[model samples]
Each structure stands twice: as C-alpha cells, then as structure tokens.
Target: MYTLNANEAKTKFGAMLMKVQSEPVEIIKNGSPVAVVVSLDEYNKIEQLKMELVKSRFENIDESDLVDGKTFREELNAGKYD
Candidate 1:
C-alpha cells in the first residue's frame, strides 16, 4: 500500500495510477485518510469476493425466512445483494 496527500496525488495523478497496478494507494485530505485508488482488476476481484461472502452467509438460512416470488425478485435486482 502507498499513501499520498491530496495535493501530491493531484500533481502526480498519472504516475499514481501506474503505481496502483502493483498495490492500492491511499489518498489523504485535511491530514486524514479519505480515499483509495486501486486498479480495475483489483476492484473487480474485491467485489466478487464480497458478493460471494454475502451469498455464503445466507446459505444456512431457512427457506421460510425468504420472501416469495415477485417481491423476492424485485429486491434481488435492487442492489440488495450488497
């Protein structure tokens, strides 16, 4: 991981992007951390793992706990997985 102040990040934006390919970059503002920059592949891998973890957590739930049909479909498509 790498850390950079906001001003330094802005001044070396392109170079920072290249650096992110190897590891995440933390951006700080007002002397505190604010954001992280990661490569697209890294972001995708993280999201996929998150989704899988969410799914696994529900695997042991009883069928009675789930809503029926249309309502379930609606919630499923409404970003409820996250």
Candidate 2:
C-alpha cells in the first residue's frame, strides 16, 4: 500500500492512476486516510467476492427458522449458535 497527501494526489493524479493499476493507493486528508484508488480489475474482483460472500451467508438463513430482531439478539446473547 502507498499513501499520498491531498495535494500530492491532486498534483500527481496521472502518476497515481498508473500506479493504481498494479496496487492500491490510499489518499490521506489531514493525515487521515479518506479514499482508496484501485485498478478497475481489482475493484471488480473485490465487488464480485463481496457479493459471493453475502450470497453464501444468506444461504444459511432458513425462512422456516425466522426470528424477529429482538429474538435474534436474545439468541445471540445466549450463544445458541456456539
């Protein structure tokens, strides 16, 4: 990972764009990270993986085992899944 200040990112936008093709660049504002620049391929791959993970997790949610938010919290607090 590489980090660049706001001014550095604006002045060197083109260079950063090229660099992001190979790896991510974190843009910092006031010494705090605010944004990430990544290649389209990398961004797409991340989105696809996130979608797959959500789908897999939802697959375990049985409609027949449905519970309200309060009941769900109670069950979690009771460590039923464990």
Candidate 3:
C-alpha cells in the first residue's frame, strides 16, 4: 500500500490514481488514514463476487412459485414455510 497526505494527493491526484491502479493506495488526513483507492478491475471483481454470493444464497427458491405466491410480507406474517 502507498500512503499520501492530503496536500500530496491534491497536487498529484492523477499520479496517485495511477499508482492505485497497480496496487492499493491510502489517503491520509490529519495523520490518520481516511480512504482507500483500488483499481477498477478489483472493484468490479468484488461486485461480481457479491452478486454470485447473493445468487447462491437464493438458489433454492423456486422461480415459478415466486411469481405465483402472495406478497412476501403477507406470506411472512402468515408464518408460511417454503
């Protein structure tokens, strides 16, 4: 990871962003870490992983029954089991 103070980051924003594209970079303010910058590919990979996790978690649900059923809130309040 690379650390950049506010002034340094402000004066060299483009270079800092380029550095982050190769690895992680940390922006600091008042001697404390404030934020992280990551490459777009890394960000996209994280988003894709999240979607896969959500899809797997809901894989057991029957798609046909999802549209056929009453509203979700109604089913929940009715103590229905899938």
* Ten contiguous residues minimizing lDDT sum, candidate 3: 61-70
Predictions in order: lDDT: 0.95, 0.94, 0.87
Q: Which sequence of candidate numbers ranks them by lDDT, best first?
A: 1, 2, 3
lDDT of 2 by residue, 1-82 (tens): 9889999999999999999998999999998999999999999999999999999988898888798999989999999978
| Model 3 TM-score relative to the real fold | 0.66
TM-score (all chains, Cα) for each model: 0.74, 0.74, 0.66
Kindly report which residue stretches of model 2 are placed more than 4 angstroms away from their true locations once superposed: 67-82
Candidate 3 lDDT at 8 equals: 92
In lDDT terms, how accurate is model 1?
Answer: 0.95
Q: What stretches of model 3 exceed 4 Å from their correct place? A: 61-82
Better of 1 and 3 by lDDT: 1
